[model samples]
Target: MTNSFINQWKFFYPNKLPISHCFRQYFSQFWFRIHSLPESKRYADTPAEYELLLNRHNQIIDDCFDSNASIFIVTGHYFSQSDNNKIYDPTLRLKYEFHPEKEINLTQANPENYDDDEEDHFYRPYSINEIWKKNEHNDLLKKIADDEVRAFMISFEQNIIIAPYDGGIDFIIFNDAKRNELINKYKDWLSPRADGL
Candidate 1:
């Protein structure tokens, strides 16, 4: 992260977090990416995901707001590659922007032992996108009888945007008939593309 962006974060988490926290996030992401290169004939590429990326995200959020969906938004970024094992913008669509604050509800987020598991290092109850996923008014969709989440509302500053971000992505196991129907109907838009979150 740049100094300007670091300075900007102070406005968001004033006393709880420090300026260095911002640096560690972007820096480590960039650093690890540098070390995790595929040495061979690799190059840059455009985002394989089309507008469907945004569409799928919205769909899951709609489901979560409905309170019946168990899906969690899992976001992954793809980067281009180089022969020298260096991952720079010149060769990849690296995760330049990670919205850790996007998701439904993350109040239960906690990690007991990260040392034993690398996945735990980035562990959270929700996807990395959820900025703040706790708003009661989102229950409107849950009570409404609809096969799909056409549209919805939330209560907060810029509730329309934040509500979705707070909850990462919709993750339902499809244990019953109703949710199974939803998955089958919106498979094209709901199925995750080939990317890691």
Candidate 2:
């Protein structure tokens, strides 16, 4: 039979390497479990038009994707063979939606203290502070557990899509002890933060 289609981008955390390396390793194992394909994956990269990040510091990532992206308004785009399409990554558009009249408590003591050199490889809500998590993350995570892409719960307001594991079964076997180890290792590092509109 022909190879089953899988999202190549799903192999690791949507974010890039280094800081997300733990997640990358985790997905590497998870990928081994589900992926029976070949190296012909990376399909999404054909249309992805992002400026790769040079560094892996969390602070640097926070500034790269979101801070450098357009905010306030966003749109979905369709790409052709020769052009880049915005829909290639559904989470590409995100802008922080907060009330304007209240005392705004910036996430950390110094919101500007974030390193402004790099970009987040994946997607994140702009208001996603270190301690601030999403109210609707559980269901979305459940969908991932079920291996459903349509089940991928993304906040329309936030424009975030939780990607699946990549590399396939070649990375790790399903429900094996190594699977749990992979999960635990990457439990914290896979989050992506990009602020754009």
Candidate 3:
């Protein structure tokens, strides 16, 4: 990624980590969560359910972006203390299957002390640009639904972020008006809790 693009991200999200899960907390006013399956189910139980999950993801992605929109797909890999010095590894691409060419290191500001003898690790996020096409990313989305990968898609044009985890997808929209539109559009997929999860 170019310094200008990275700087743009920092400008919009100052003092915030580039990790997807952390976005919801820091950008809560612009965040929205939607479950992949009906009735708050976490995972797909059957092939049909998997279809539903992917469809839900694609629908929202379509809403957030335009046809053939250029988006940055971000995926992270963690490195323990022993491997902290390494920058890039060819084997890492095999795990993500996205072949991201650009990378940015995001280290833990304050490493937590674990009594279980676990070593501190830092996250290195790799990103690549791809064109958004309907149903074209089902394979990657399926992997996300199965907890096989963690990734997020960003549309610079729309200034929105879409992060898909195992159970659902989290959105960091441009503003409250757009966020409210999404919430009203997919009200049924939202959580029942007051916290919005």
Best of the candidates, lDDT: 3
Task: For each candidate in turn, give its C-alpha RMSD to the true structure in angstroms.
Answer: 16.7, 18.4, 3.8
- Which candidate do you rate higher for lDDT, 1 or 2? 1
The local distance difference test score of each candidate is: 0.27, 0.26, 0.76
The residue-by-residue lDDT of candidate 2 on 82-177, one tens digit each, is 444445532332332321221112223223633462322222211222221332233322222233322121122222222223222122233456
Please, what are the lDDT tens digits per residue for candidate 3 over residues 99-160?
A: 43334433345434333445655666666678899898887788778877778888777888
TM-score per prediction, in order, is: 0.24, 0.21, 0.82
Find the candidate with the highest TM-score and give its number: 3
**Model 1 ranges with Cα > 4 A deviation:** 1-50, 67-170, 173-175, 189-197
In terms of TM-score, how similar is model 3 to the real structure?
Answer: 0.82
The runs of at least 3 residues in candidate 3 whose Cα sits more than 4 Å from the true structure, single-residue gaps closed, are 1-7, 83-108, 111-120
Superposed by TM-score, candidate 3 places the C-alpha of residue 197 at a distance from the truth, in angstroms, of: 1.8
Could you tell me which 10 consecutive residues in candidate 3 have the lowest summed lDDT? 88-97
Candidate 1 residue 142 Cα shift, in angstroms, is 26
Q: Mind giving the per-residue lDDT tens digits that candidate 1 earns over 38-94?
A: 221122122333223333444554543444322222222212122223232211221
